[model samples]
Target chain A: MIHFLLKGVLHDRHRSLLPLIVITLGVALTVLGHAWVNGVLGESFVMSAHFSTGHLKAMTRAYAEEQDQMPIDLALIGVKEIMDELAGIGEVDWAPRIRFGGLIDFPDESGSTRSQGPATGFAVDLLTPGSKEIDRFNLTSSILSGHIPTREEEALITYDFAEKFHIQPGDRFTFFGSTMEGSMAFGNFIVAGTVRFGAEALDHGAILIDLTAGQRMLGMPDAAGEILGFFNNNRYDQKEAQAIADSFNARRSGSTDEFAPLMVTMRDQEGMAQLFDYTHIISAILITAFVLAMSVVLWNTGLIGGLRRYGEFGVRLALGEEKSHIYRTLIYEALLIGLIGSVIGTVVGLALALYLQVVGLDMGDAMRASTMMMPSVIRTQVTATDFWIGFIPGLFSMTLGNALSGLGIYKRSTAHLFKELEA
Target chain B: MENKQIIDINNLVKRFPIGDGYFTALQGITLRFVAGEFAGLVGPSGSGKTTLLNLIGSLDSPSEGSVVVLGHEVSRLSHRESAALRNYHIGFIFQTYNLLPVFSVYDNVEFPLLLQKRDAVGRRKAVMEALDWVGLSHKAQSRPAQLSGGECQRVSIARAMVKRPELVLADEPSANLDAKNSHHIIQTMKRLNRELGTTFLFATHDEKVMGYLDRIISLDDGRVARDERPLCVNEAQSDSTAEENGHARRQARI
Candidate 1:
């Protein structure tokens, strides 16, 4: 019976051709859709982890509350000691950064402040060979001007800021801001280079300086606003990272120090939590819609095929083939179609995803005016789920399609069919 | 009905609903058929021969009376039970030689045995033997579309006899064939009947088919009009009594 059915399907080009084509195209779209959704959401998360937030961040409660204000007085003290503990954990890599804002003064040969403008400064450990800051900013790819700062008092400014000030490498500048003690503090530095952050908000009036220079200028020893910890696995899964943060904080819940540091995962950050939640809901709705539409089309295909074979079905019934057996065989034939089609579709979809990942689609032109932290080229992110996600809709929709359509056969009486055969 | 009969029909009446009224296709069809008997319900169109054959095969239930084959009432059989009856005991042949177009001759012959869940070896042996009986063993691999009308009817006969069924019901088995093929098919069925002692019941208006039957149950206007049994092949072939009855039939028709 199986051999008979298989031969019938494979040899009957007229009946099988359209269903196979529909199944193949439907499965291909299903595979591609899953990969695209997983790619967009997964890449968005990793991008956020690398630039705006680490997998987890630790800071004093007061510092966290006033983090938007860049309050140096509320910054974590003994930053090296806290970072040492975080770094000892196998899954964690810690980086200390001082996010502060101040006025940058361009000095003439007279050593006086000639022109000044408000600038945001990120003081990071750039001298370390494997430092997280360099990778996080992807600074190597953004060097539009000279170079990243190698000297203690050298700074890397944004191309916009440099153009605004007509600044050049080796040009002298003075950074002036209030110290943690509310007293006067200032430092002079040479411009090292200019760079673009690939984000409109970050590329304007931004400067990068070494950590030691900022500490000296702030007049606050061993102080950083926060210690960012990245998970070594690089997935930065929010739920897992949040659980780890909760565990870490619980261990220090009895600490009497009012300024004690607390841990927060990436999900705790503003503007990101809602985005994460919406990603799942939107992907589910989109996937459901696609599956339903494809399944319905396949169902119609099965129904039309069944109608075309009405005589064959009637003959089978006359030959004493049970109704259930006929229905089951119909579904089995559908499964064969789905199995072949899904393999073809998955291969094509995976090929497309690989192409996008390796040779990313450049969105630079569209992104120039955008303030979001996403990179211009949005590459597909293939998770383990993408490997077999297509079968859910491919096999199921077709199986369900044929099964639903075959139900009409049961409704037809064998007597009626046998009589119809007489016609 | 005789106690030793393989199939017994008692007061069977079949009606098909047409619009608001019922069209009586069979009325009070009462008959008993014994083992090894080659019988045919001989009649013209609208004589309810096919309807009575359907009841005897358990493919359908009688509207008024009981059709008991092998002691199980056809009217009382569940769908599965009716299917099982056909699967194990009864085999059917159709007018158009309805060979499953997708299957080869061997598969078509092997179909009834497959329903009986016969092992591969057993099915192959039985199918080959039936095809040999029909003298189409050389065309075992050929599909129905690849065969001539005579060959297709021979395959249909092979399919019906492959399982060694106790009762074989044929509805106009020679209707689609020419005189040569029709004679050839009936001779093959007659040989199988004599050699295997399988009871045969045919629903046909074709005189060539009636010429081979050992027993003839003539029907007219949905009722049994005559019952006769020719003692030998010569008597069955001559069938002068049936020819005289045909005159009566025409008179009844007028």
Candidate 2:
């Protein structure tokens, strides 16, 4: 029986090839869609974990609220002592960050004295000695190009900003801002080697400067926003960290009224978490649509062809073939079709995913700047799991379509042979 | 347990609904055929020969009577049981040789064996022998479409005999064949019957088929009109009858 069914399918190979191809491609696409979403999320998570936050992060609520406040300035004098105290505790690894927001002026290269828009700058203590957090955060390479700031003046601008302003390793740039004493202040720093992080938003706007200089420039002396910590293992209790933060807040009872509210800990970095959530929703919608469309296509192709084979079924029945045998044979044919289609589709989809990973999707520069808040080149990362994930939807669609078609074939009455033959 | 009757029909009747009314296809047909008999059912179109064949073949149930084939009450059988009984015990040859298009000639012949529990080696031997008997062993590997109409009919005959059934019912077996193919198919079937002692019942309208039958049952308006033994009895019986008639004629002359 199986032999006959197989021979029948092969005999009609020409007729079945079109549907098989269509079904296989559909399955592959389904797999690819799932893989794409997973790859994007997984890659983003790894980048965020490596460059911004480890598995867990701790920061003051005040630093989280006031984006411009330097975390080192908000730190109490005893904050480092407390951090050291916590560091000795089991699995506690701390990295203190001094965050500051400033602006980068892209010098006009047209010889015109026209003012250009200021690119946003973010300064962090990325090169502290023996700091595992800083080491992890430096995803690309060393922070500054020429050297670490011997004085509180040197800065490292992002690759995007440096490219925009034609700044190099030895070039000096002046920064002017109000001091903490309400007096005008200015300084100059040598340009450092630029670091390239793949993320468009990070590459385009961020600049690194000396934490002490940022503290002085922000006019927050001996005050810091919050201390950032990464645990060796993500076993530290958020409640415990919050409790310590609250105690610090209590000790600073007479602080300025404008002091930002302090927070304790968060799991994921802010930018990464937002991007992941957004992409997840989009991926889900795309996958659902793709699956639905593929299922419909498969159903249409399989069922229509199956129904058309009724005359053949009738003839078999007339020759004393059992209806069960007929049903089994048709289902076997469908299974073969599904198997072939799924294999082809999986291969095609995986290849497409790999290609996409290699040569990333580049939205034009203006659109990239407007939508992504980063550079134009955004490459998708391919993962092994992505291929497997992409393969499933296609395989499922093929099976489902073929099963439904088989049912339609089974529903046909064998007694119709007389009338069918007469026609 | 050694019964002679191969088919037993008791007041079998068949009616079909046409539009809002009923059309009687067969009106109380009661007939029987013993084993090893070659019988022909002759009728014009719409004359109930097919209805009677359908009932006897267990393809359909009688409206109001019993049809027993090979000691089993066919009307009482379930659809699956009927199909099984037909596959194992009764061989059916249709007006159009219904060979599966996907199957080769040998596979088509071996189709009935698949329903049984025969192993592949046994099935192959049986199919090869049947095809040999039909003189189509050379065309065994050819598909049905590749064969001529006559050759296809021969393949169907092989399929029917491969199961070694007790009764073979051929419904207009040569309806689609040329005269030559029809004669060849009839000769092949007759040979099979003689060699295997399988009872054959044919429902056909062909006059050319009448000359080849051992018995003819003419049907008209859903009833048997004439049941005649067209073949001579044994030579012994014929000689005795001739002697008795000659002596009576001499006495009359005296």
Candidate 3:
């Protein structure tokens, strides 16, 4: 019976063609839209994680509250113990970093300052063997000129800062800042390289130095302002990060010291919680709207198709077919159309998504003036959900449309049909 | 013909609504037919011949009185029961040939057997036999749209006869055909009646159809005005015989 109905549908272009095309296009748009949204939001989260937030971060309670101020006075002490303890949490790579403010003075052939500017600096474990900081900061690709620091007393400065100060690689500069204990701090460093991190805020006046140099120059040994913990998989796991933070905080719950250590997940900082929540809500609303709109269009299509087949329905009914049977076949026909259309749409949508994923749109000009830590080129991320997202609207809208249109079959009287036929 | 009664109508009345009032299409119609009788309800338009046929076929119920077809009261049967009666025991042929335009001639003919859930081999044989009976076996794969009017009607007849139903109700079977095609269609039905022993009842005013029926019940203004058998009779004698036969059949049914 199904085979017979299938043959009928295949042979009759007037019945199935328009509905199939509508379904295919609707589903394709849905799949591509979903993938595009996931891609943009996913990329944003990953960039923020790598540059500003790690999967997790640990700092003193007072420093966390005043974190935006880069308060080195409230920094974590005895970082070796914290690093050892964090290693037991899960698959994580822990790194210590110090965010500092200092003055960099370019020196002439003499030992006196030629020019000076205030700068923001990140002191990382650059000299440590097998350190992941180089990869984490993506410094190799961002180098505009020169090389990264290869020895003590060496540092990397931003391309913009170098261009502004007319400082070149292999030149010497004096760094002057206050120590954690509120005393004077001073150092002289050779400019090893110049780099650009792409983001306007970071590339403006940034400098990078070895963690050991930072500790010595700031009169603090075996200490860091903050420690970042990144997942080994290079993807953020919210639940695992939250679990670790909760457990770490619980262990120190009794400590009333203002300087006691605390842990925070990436979402706890930078308003990420609200951003991700909005993405989820938007995705749900997008799919629902698509389904409703497509259903209405397909419903009208089915209504017209049903009206055209009124005579055929009467003939089937007169031949001893129950009204329910005819209605059931309509639904079965819709199901077959939905399945075929969805497969085709998914293939088309996924192909477009894969292309965008490989060759992302470059927004270098758009991001030049932006102070946010967002990447210039944005690409799509196709998740498992994208593979089946189209089928929801495809199958449901087609079935619902045909089911509503088929109600007319029950209202027709076979007697009246026969009378009309006789006439 | 067998003496077993296949359809017994008792004072049947059918009314259709028009605007605010009712238009009576069949009023106080009483009739009966035995198995294997080739019969027709003869009348002009609005005379209710098609209405009476519809009642007998269980496609409709009487507004008053009863229509008992194959021992089941038409008014008392549920939709499923009526459909089952039609599927298993009855067949219908329409004036329009009403073949599904998308289906080929063979599939249209095989439709009833498919409803009966016959096996593939049986269905194929039954459909082919019905097609062969109508001399359309060679055009089994052709769709209804591809066939001429006469060929389309033959396909309709084959479909109606394919199930070997106990009763076949045809409404204006030759109304859309030319005289030559009409005669050919009526002849095909008559031959199927003789060969299959199926009770054939037609609702038609066409003289070509009347010439082939063994029994004719003529209706006028929704009432049975004449009932007779044997085509070549004197007008006065046929009228007198129709009255006597109708009265005798009503008495026998009571």
Over all chains combined, what TM-score does candidate 3 have?
0.80
Q: Candidate 3's residue-wise lDDT over B65-94, tens digit each?
A: 999999999899988888888988898888
Candidate 1 lDDT over A1-423, as tens digits, reads 676678778767645667778777877777677777777677767777776578888889877777778888888899878877776554778888888888999987897767899998888888877787887787898778888889898999988899989999889898888887788779888899888876656776888999888888887689887778888777667777878788878878999675799888888875677877887789888878876777777667766776666667666676677778888888888888878877777787788877887777777677777767666666776667666776766677777767776887777667776776677
Question: In candidate 2, what are the lDDT values of residues A265-296, reduced to their tens digit?
Answer: 43334664566567668777876777777777
Q: Tell me the TM-score for chain B of model 1.
A: 0.90
Q: A381, model 3: CA deviation in Å?
A: 2.7
For candidate 1, give the lDDT of residue A114: 72
Q: Could you tell me how far off, in angstroms, the CA of residue B53 lies in candidate 2 after the best superposition? A: 3.8
lDDT of each: 0.80, 0.66, 0.83
* Best of the candidates, DockQ: 3
- Encode model 1's per-residue lDDT on B107-154: one tens digit a residue: 888877877788999999999999999999999999899999999999
Docking class of 1: acceptable
lDDT of 2 at B40: 86
DockQ of 2: 0.32
Residue B66 lDDT, candidate 1, scale 0-100? 86
Worst 10 residues of 3 chain A by lDDT: A414-423
